[model samples]
Target: MATRPASDTQVLAGRPFPLGAHPEAGGVRFAVTSAVADAVEVCLIADDGSERRIELTERTFGVWHGLVPGVTPGQRYGYRVHGPYDPSRGLRCNPAKLLVDPYAYRVTGRLTNLHAAQGFVGDPARGPASTVDSLGSVPLSVVMSPGGPDTGAKPEVPFEESVIYEVHVKGFTEQHPFIPEALRGTYLGLAHPVSIEHLARLGVTTVELMPVHAFADEPSLIRAGRHNYWGYSPLGYFAPHPRYASEPGREVEEFRTMVAALHAANIEVIVDVVFNHTCEGGPDGPTLSLRGLDAPAYYLHTKRGHMADITGCGNTLDAGSPTVVRLVTDSLRYWTQELGVDGFRFDLASTLGRPRGGMFDRDSTMLTAITTDPVLSGCKLIAEPWDATGEGYRVGDFGAQWAEWNGRYRDTVRDFWRGVTGVRDLAFRLSGSSDLYDHNLRRPWQSVNFVTAHDGFTLRDLVSYNDKHNEDNGEDNRDGTNDNRSWNHGVEGETEDAAVLALRTRQARNLLATLLLSTGTPMLTAGDEMWRTQGGNNNAYCLDDETSWLDWTPSAASEPMLAFTRRLVRIRAESPALRQPEFFEGRTTVTGKPDLVWFRPDGEEFDEADWFDEDRRSLCLWIDGSNSQARNREGALVTDHSWLLVLHAGDEPLDVVLPSREYGETYKPTLDTSTADGTPAHPGVLEPKGRITVEARSLLLLRAPRDIVEGPQTP
Candidate 1:
């Protein structure tokens, strides 16, 4: 419903301030920063596909500016700048191609393939019917309307106080029966009260939406009618994918509304951003915005113009270059300053850390700018930590300001639960991977722990598949990792065997327990609590159908998992001990006992043999709960309290000796995971026995009387 500006406009010398686009007295002032361009033309395309090119006369600070008097919000436009075609010095400007406004708040055009628009070396016959090199000159304008500019809303939830739920926007609610058919798989569907209420009930503070930006369906997948369901191949950074919005050109407003709605419910939004590379592949790939505009500058290249393939995508973005950094920084600022998003989860974050030598530099200018930038200071910044490049698999290497997806936590927890158990691995992760994160004085929360995410198998599928069933992904089964380390519980995929189902559900609970109980910040994949599965398709980055959606109606197992998750979150929120910002010291300041004491079922400290023995599956953990930074959520300090956690890595039952609590307190049986009904096995106190039997592949938590101890004392 946006209107176009008048045909003829004066070339008024616009102010060069406010770099990208902003509201002016008459309409919207358009500006783009490019030091090399001889001239920049803003092309306004009408509904009838007619174009009016307006030259921006005012230029300053490597920026071209012009005020279009009548161009209102939602107007479709693009730019074409005249510049040198020399590729050797990293300049390849093709004025024939219509370029996307790097700052455009909303996009209105439909993506169509054109053969000439691709690199000349590729098979020209593989493109769409219209073989013209130019993608119709249309300027996608950025403007301010009734709402004025964005409010730069920030939820400002700290890592310790945050619980992330990673989900796909479309797959999350696509098959949700409560959501209307038309709205399903759209932003509106995700924003529905049912969706928000469910997340709220689960007590997750943030929703890490997987790639809501405009993305392309890989050509091979398109031929097979399957697509990139995760939307990692970004087509536009500033604009939300049009399909997620209710209608074309409404994506901005829709996304803003979704943020607002979630904010009202006290949940923040974190986008899974893929700036490591673009949809435009290698030398023979499609010529999208950056590639068509200036190939070498925007993308990393070899001496002979071949694309650098660090990202495992056909090409890697030249984050080392200023223009590429500017684009990334500008896009980040736009999402925070203009679109009002809470934060971003960088996909393959190593790409952003890439320096000239293809090595990671913590002091990289881009990382420095983003962490210190005023606009992004209050927003959450998380990284996936590793990429396909292999050089930059920096888990704890990122500076202290950022939180990293603890991939080690994921792998270890999976391996332990799948019967490859060990006590050392469990102890390290439970105390928040001190070996990985503590070297730089970083807190436990710096490690964002999770058992599964959108990129891998769901909690259900993890216990149900030994290998990836990604055949439907059109990449054969070879697309996903072969090192899943998952177990199928003696039955692959779905099963009618009630015993196997029971085992899988228990494993799911064990995984969830491990994730939440870990000292680091916990992140749960959305629908994991409800036992959602992608049919064992670990790499469901493609497949937007029911495979990714959250089935609202939970089965018996899903219901139990959901309730358990809610209870676990409540327990975590109520107890300050579980959410420490600092690393746990082995010895307590108030008491002489180790703050975290490890024990074998034989009530003895772990030996070197125990640490290395792969068979060392059964172990007990004693946390000096009195060392909790503060009281519970009710502000009541349960003084001198202690808890012993027993973890049996396999399906064998073993006796766990409860370590004596400080100050003569007695042990109270709080929860046991072996029950098939998902409820506590014993409501009353167990006989004050030194040893308790714990089932295999189960977790047991025992609470000590709070009043017995006045200060820490050696057991």
Candidate 2:
């Protein structure tokens, strides 16, 4: 692939359909969408450090395109769109500042010099466009081939059976001792043998990796000497973040390799994506990719020309626009079809479903496009179903095809364990949040239930800290969430008292047990199984160092919690009743027993009176496996022993009376969260209607004998 002569570059009018730089046998054809630009030029940087500027003479519709007969794949380039710089009219284009392709597959370098990256070259305070050229300072897009060899088959785990482990790519392996020093904190590091072994041992079917898309640190964070460790601020939608790649120019391949490795281990890879906003902040922000190309069309703006801050981020992408929708859909297809991702978890997903300046609608253009798109509909889709704007807390409103992060489950469970709420809300969470998700013919698994996530406290810190400890995040500790429903067991922070440590450990187990055994798709934070803590920092989004990394060196408390979590997962896997595919309707089965039964501590059926009992800290749930509608590998109806799970969140142990023999004759204890091996103090079968002791702030699971025949009872 030789460089084309200036004459050929000047004369060739390229095809404009593909919308990015496409490498062909003769040369590369460049195309970009800039509806408002008067002129667009493709600035190609050669291997010899020389630059060639080719004005895209062809315009089909709103796209500017041209071809250079010799430019090949590996050539670096950027776009220079000539347009007005009027802010009030929402046009912020400046040809002086080099712009990245909105569909760039790979980008090199960072936006270190903000002033040079901004469209306004002079004093930003004066709000005027800069006349100086930014070709020397801004990062350039590297043209690359679009397709690759198939990296094996995806695991394609079903949502009902999937257990998601949300993890940060770099932070997950940053302190991993088993990973090689050079590979640690990179894409390759996540696919390391040790990382795979940990996930496999923990029994998670999917690894929901935090954002790996190319992102930039906020200028405010840069000035404060802090970085966005979570990678929520996206820079390039098509490219993997280069900082997470072990080697230069191999970010895409490295990401594909990671996905392949996880697939080989039968674990799916789901990435958390931020399409709600870009790193380009408010009106005073820099002009990088879409903002510079056409801010008015790319972002949702108020009538006064200010950005609609629906994401709490300074700017929100106009997902309703046809151009932005195409960009998003194309990017999703690239990741799933080309990069081999199993799924995606959209952050602030409600923002994507909002029509310009309107409320969030389930039938909004972007949401409907995604769920109906042939390429994307086949892949798993998860939504963080809310934004920071009006009516954004839509936990169960994202239709049946999409699963949601149940924020209500998190808050209710935390409140229950903290003794701030009664058994009513706790029962709802434990039963897969049926009240929230059951309206639209949704199954139990539509609720992705969890008590902790990346944006909140770790399971360990949740028990050790009463309030968020984020002073180190700067901004005088005002950045993170303050309403962290956490409870410190006697002490506020780290304590040396054995009694306090014991209570904290038990509370941690209680939370983990509830999360794994609950009737929904449970998601565990990466380090929660190993008792990882952020030093009480509920939000460590800014701390890229030790504060956010998982400490591989386990503590005394971590070992037991890890063992307990593994045992809980195993029990859940063995018991089909625990992970029911459908919502429990309380209908009487052929066995003369309800498919699901709820009881008070005294062995009586729970009535309306028991729900509002403020002092009630315990409840008993019986799940009938015989009522399951799932089929096994042999195409036979799946059935297992019925299970009775007793959960007590009180401060003292209590005697729980078992249900009558009408349900089953005898029960065998399977798991007790208070014990290291999930063993009960008195192991063995207990007669039906017998009393068993449940420990304080812990959960117990018992399996009913399969041989016991159902007795005659009234339906």
Candidate 3:
């Protein structure tokens, strides 16, 4: 191969200690890792679109290094690694293809699905090296100045008190009327005063933004004129997605500004990171950054050189490799330390804990490394805890330090509120799913419980659609999950019948109540509190338009629902017994009462037969806050007034007899989900063993005074 002269710009052998292009005092040093490549050329693209090829003269421990004297920050560059182009051996190195830097701080342009971008010269069907230069086809990695130190402090809310709100940065503010048109759907919009005030009023402790890493639209989606709206298909892990920024080259700063703003509002920021796979699909996919550099080292491959697709995204990252582990850990540290992010929620997290050709391991190298690392261990680390590979549904199998998205909690809560499952499963879920997470010395907060997320139906759709409406995804309605435990409440989709609409509203309240009142770290999807809908689209991952954006316009149910949600959050915050950190021991404590007691509608403790009774849907839970095992910050035992929570999932209102005088002498109603403002018209006191009416598909909380008093039962 012929090389261009280095006469125009002086090049020197640079140090290979730090990867990617780093701008120093006089020039920029470029370093990239390509273990199997025989030659590597760093192409510097000038403002006029002219290219200067500088071959890296020094190779240190598989890293090619070169320094360009005149090149500085904002210089657009890419790599062309030369080696054998043999895909069967998992080595597809094509010098003609302009490759992205794995550690690119910012990517300048978008990638088009053109034939020239392919590694092969001719049709990819024949599998031959591409002699055509791909300099103009692929995006260039821009050399960026290192970000300054984060002087802002992170809002490290304790897990027991945290209420997470998962939102897509773009979708959350895309249609907000209060935000300026130029700033809408950008990081600045998310950090706007209106956004922060709404979140502060709603009482969420953390805002878990879905994947913001620099990502690419899949070639197939582009071919079909669709887009990957979720931003899960990552291209560079270190860079923030440029599309979400207000201006060019300001993504990192804008992301930091958003984090600072949220922190100022006492809300933590948890970014949803997708390190399990890349936009570069299967073995026949495009030759992007990692694939062109060293596919075998970065991705898991079968014996025949095929990609091991555990993430269902074509290729699963081989976290077992030290190189990949270093890359992931470094990326996380950068986000937490430099960008001021408080935590991370790993997407497809099971893939990170699974070994090659093995099941998901609780003690995987990646899991141990993350939990033991000093910086990451101090920060919150949450896992989705499941993938699409073999036995990947390890919900509670993650390390003790890590919290998991409790899938069992989600399913059981949905089933119970849908009025299909029995009270037994509901009881288990309400108590933070001890059956799934209790064995590993995990606390209740370790289970991040939620009814819906970005991947599934929104809370409104959960009560409006019985089936997923994903035809707009351009996949012929074949995409998205089928096991949506949803009920349409008398009619499918929107309804005009007053009774039907009322029932839907009631059911939505019931679901939200269960999620908040349950003993776990509850996660609320962004617009669930205001009854946002996706028009029955359960999987809006591909719908970037109105179907996915949160409509700020108030609907008929918006005010009441928002008020109810705010009240629920306030109640959860005020009541320590509802959000206990420890598991219920089911035994008497120092206060001479069990921390938790279950009662049937007849005011009797649940028997074994009652647990197995499928028809039993309403039950009463007496939580003895005075007997709580949780301790306060000063190491003293915390104490609060006892409380009673009545849950009724049946179709008709039921009269529930309060537990006998032994539990408490007097009870006062605190919250009722059936009421528009979550407060009853007439405040009343009830004697022990008194009967209180609970509406259909509603939840009620009663405060039981610690001091015993003989009081008359008020109807």
Candidate 4:
């Protein structure tokens, strides 16, 4: 050990109110929370790889605090928590393994030697503590400037008007030819004029970026020369992934600039956060930040000290513990205030509500803390709403404050287009799933509806492949989910058959139109609009090459698909009846017409029996947009145009009639998914009771003339 620092001058007692290392006027104030450690040493590392260890003598509550007089900003450091290494009690504090600061705003270095960072010597689950020093193997924390969170202005878009785009930071900009070579795959690349222009044109109000938090690839993958491309394994919450930054040692500024640019484009930034678990796998895994500091308080464990892996990620963070709750809440607040992000999408969110005993609770301590938080409560909160275990899947159980990724909507919509489901479940999904989210004062927007997300197949692949092709994942092609409800039109993978290709394009259009026109917030996956494909690899989470990156120069179908997607977005922006604030009741609206009425192909209202008929695949929705129940953001009443949406899933085309005079006076065709383009080249203007032929496996949207027309809206 290095010589002890002079307690009088070199080390001074510091406050422990805010954890993490913060550079002050003279030096840096270091504070870390650890309940089971006997002592904590702040190890400062020089450029030459030499470390000077200073023991923090003052202990307040569960936090250790000390101030070093000569510490400056950007100085590299870490902690060596000294305590018992008893695995039976779930305590694994080893001074040999240099632990990362839980609240580290920035972390540097790479994890090269997995075993060197492990705490145990023999059988990792139960063995003597290792004497090997991890200072040369693991990453170290860096001191950041002292400040409150960033107060940059946010778009603050309402859920009713938000169209979220889920994109990976690297994959989004990697293949863009217009972006400069140096800025490609960096934070500045996403914020560049070209990137912003694409998002603006797509009409996405918010960009829900996949994990940009500092992460580490699994040791098994590292040894195999593969990486966790999606970045689900988080190493540091506060630190933005340094790989995305264009300038070295300036990742914070670069991330802030990216947020500022997106906000300027009227788009909100929502980061996908992984607070349910850490990079540390299990008792047999390596000793990272939380695992090495105080495993009992940070992780949920069995009585024998083995991790209770509810997330199927080797270990589940104990959300029930106050220490863990504080860490999560503080991290959220820090990201919100300091980083200028508008919201968060919690990954495996069910684990956050499972306080104790591995059962999910809506009123868990963790949920309450975030809801009651002054800064975080106002920010948009989206939940994945599921975990790895069967009992952890708690969809539609989150409160009104949260919007969930509606897995049912995704499954039902896919099934409807694939001819596997009847119109009853499809109707419930299309009209804002009241059966699942009607309670808790939840509005229609609480369901963050999505047909294709980051975890599943892209929209292009969803129609081109009936099964997953994950052979390159090195998991024997058994890694991705087998429950993909997809259709290949006729042939699998890639083909030059024009008939099959045309049908595939139509199917893709049907899915996208359903998602955007549904009565909830819609999330579009990146590169879906450009007809990007992974060659049917539904689980391309490991292959980070061309298999994952968005190819701007994609198929010839790219132009039409991208144009159709933008048209759908514009149509949703112009029609409020399509994205209603309240559930449709089939009652009279302000126009003295039914708020929403389901009709048969013969222009008759759907009876109870028609809904459950398995053969019924065609349905027409007459939505009265004279919305008396809706109030704008300024608390003013707003009325939009009524719409007649016709959907047909059968193979043969059918003749459909418009509703009588009671529903509308005249209708103009706004969109037709059957056409090569989204709109018909020669549309026929007609009155009520007029007849038209609806093509198979297609959707048509006809708008009722609005006396008070609203212009095209953003997001």
lDDT (tens digit, per residue) of candidate 4 on 62-154: 899988898899899999999989888888999999988989998888788887898898886678999888888898898888553243678
For residue 86, what is the lDDT in candidate 4? 88
Residue pairs in candidate 3 whose N, alpha carbon or C atoms collide under 3 angstroms: 121-130
| 91 Cα displacement, candidate 4 (Å) | 1.1
TM-score of each: 0.91, 0.96, 0.96, 0.97
What are the per-model numbers of colliding residue pairs? 9, 1, 1, 4
Pick by lDDT: 1 or 2, better one: 2
Where does model 4 exceed 4 Å of error?
1-9, 147-151, 709-715
- Candidate RMSDs in Å, in order, are 3.8, 2.9, 3.6, 2.6
- Candidate 3 regions off by >4 Å? 1-4, 121-126, 148-151, 631-635, 707-715
Residue-wise lDDT of candidate 1 within 41-128, one digit each (tens)?
Answer: 8877776767778889788877789887877765667777677654444455666667776666665544455344543433322322
Model 4 residue 158 CA deviation (Å) reads: 1.0
Question: Residue 499 of candidate 1: its Cα lDDT?
Answer: 88
User: Candidate 2 lDDT, tens digit per residue, 1-715?
Assistant: 1334455444388688888889875898889998999998888877765667788889998999887787888889999889887767788888877888988899987777777777774544347887766766667799998765455698877687889999999998988888999999998999899999999999999999999889888889977877888999998999999989899998888898888888999999999999999988877777778888988889999886777788888999998899989989999998998899988999999988887947878889999999999989998899999899658878889976899999999998889888777889888888888899888778889899999999989999999998888888887778788888998988999999999988888888888888998999999998888888889887788899898998889778788788888888887776767887878888676568888899887999999888889988898999876676444544455666888999888889989999888877789888887786577766789998999998888888898867422323233
List the candidate 1 regions with Cα displacement exceeding 4 Å: 1-9, 86-91, 119-133, 136-155, 589-591, 630-640, 661-664, 687-689, 707-715
Residue pairs clashing in model 4 are 149-337, 149-338, 150-337, 150-338
Residue range with the least summed lDDT across 10 consecutive positions in model 2: 706-715
Candidate achieving the largest lDDT: 4
